[model samples]
Target: MRTRRRFLIAALAAGTAFALAGCETLNTVTGLLGNQLNFTQPQLQRYLNHSFPREFDKLGGLVSATLTNPRLSIPSGDNRLRLDFDIGVSALGARDVSRGHFALASRLRYNPATQGLHLDNPEILAVDVPGAGSLLSGGTRELVNTVLVEYARNEPVYRIDSDVLNRLPSGKRIGATDIEDGRVVVRLQ
Candidate 1:
């Protein structure tokens, strides 16, 4: 009888262990099925890299500017994304181009219909032209803002995959998007 009781005790312990393990597995699976989609900084940078070297002509094509080498970063403690670019400016007929650096920060706006992320409320952080101090301070700032607005309106920084969205449960969709923990997060609801 003692031997039989020992065997029953072992079986009970084994069953409890299996039940605990099953609960853990279920928790992990539900976590994976949660309503969050994350895009890392490198992924976003890859998309932005393909949209670079945008050229703009103003003043009836007399003044021209080219924005290239887009570098993206998320500033600590801030919810905005920053983009730094190499800017080249020149007259329409001039061979000499003034080189500068352009920095801008903006919030991310996601359009569910288009599955695209756009730069929202972009503002110029800095416009640095080495050895040409204050050269791009006033009128040039306005011109850069114009180019920024145009770029923000027409170009999407990154696009969400429709296939991924389609896999979500029916009637659920992305409700909010933000820059968090150095990642672009799309929260579904």
Candidate 2:
């Protein structure tokens, strides 16, 4: 009886050690595979889609615009993302709403404080207000530009949760963000 009890304790100890070693090996493998996170074009598009339609009021509520139907794409080898969306503008209590299309192109930048990706150096490619030929001129264009600036500065295009980062080993954090093969790849270290 005494020998059986000693053997049982030894066996339990060995099993516990083996389980710990297996966990260590698993951790190493997870670290290797978790070095990067890939976000495809469709995933990015979905994120942007859910974020709109963003509404803005300018000129002391005289001009109001809503941005909707966001279409996002990551062009191959371009290292930039493009967003094309529809805009509806109403002015001075007018019942008629002017519809337009706006295309914006920008590079992506990572914000450490937010643990998210934001638009960087955004440039307006096109602003087409159909039937309103000169709408992209002067005040209208400036208002649109102002709205874009606010979006780029304040809103994150893609957010990385802390729990996701916690999956990495200690001392590892996102190191770089790049576009490759029409996907956004976030690399960690």
Candidate 3:
């Protein structure tokens, strides 16, 4: 009886640990802006298929319009959309902000009758600003906000509310220019 009790306790502990470890794998937008965005293969695939392209058209277009030679490309995939683009900020006279890369994993949705496109849960996995060096932090929020606002105006399907933006760490007004990197990241999700 004593041996059986000990074995049951050991098994319960092991099982608890395994369950907790699995929970850690769930990824959220908060994780990405914090540079902690991690997703399982299936989660990543779902994000790519449902949310990527619309995000690309909205945010990606802003980045493209604001910068120079902003190349956007979507590669074909079985389940989701994969895109890689490069933009130079020099055209805006902010040479320091001119060079960056944006990568997106997302999926596409369409309404046959309306011929409309919808993207869901698209994640901006990486944004690399090589030229601005540290200054990238200064304008990252402005850039992100600009994209978000543009998204709101152009894409009715994207449900970004001012309340959600206000819930972000900065707590600054949605259009406020004081925003920095961490604030921008927190709102990205």
Backbone clashes in candidate 2 total 0
What is the C-alpha RMSD, rounded to one decimal, of candidate 3?
16.3
lDDT of 3 at 143: 55
User: Which regions of candidate 1 fall more than 4 Å away from where they truly are?
Assistant: 1-32, 112-114, 130-138
How close to the true structure is residue 23 of candidate 1, measured as C-alpha lDDT? 61
User: Highest TM-score among the candidates is held by which one?
Assistant: 1
- Model 2 over residues 35-102: C-alpha lDDT tens digits? 87777676677668788889988777877778899999887778889989898877775667889888
Over the stretch 128-164, how does candidate 1's per-residue lDDT look in tens digits? 7553333333456777888888788878898866666
Q: Backbone clashes per model, in order?
A: 0, 0, 10
- Residue pairs in steric clash, candidate 3? 48-106, 48-107, 49-106, 49-107, 49-108, 50-107, 50-120, 51-119, 51-120, 89-98
Q: State the C-alpha lDDT per candidate.
A: 0.77, 0.77, 0.41
Q: After superposition, how far is residue 3 of candidate 3 from its true place, in Å?
A: 96
**Preferred candidate (TM-score higher): 2 or 3:** 2
**TM-score of every candidate relative to the true structure:** 0.74, 0.73, 0.33
lDDT of 1 at 35: 74
Tens-digit lDDT string for candidate 3 (1-189): 999999999999999999865554333334434532333334433333454433222233333323322223344333444445454443223434456666554453332232223343445656675654344444553454455445433442222324433444443322211112211111222
Residue 156 deviation, candidate 1, in Å?
Answer: 0.8
Range of the 10 consecutive residues with the lowest summed lDDT in candidate 1: 23-32
Question: Which 10-residue span in candidate 3 carries the lowest summed lDDT?
Answer: 176-185
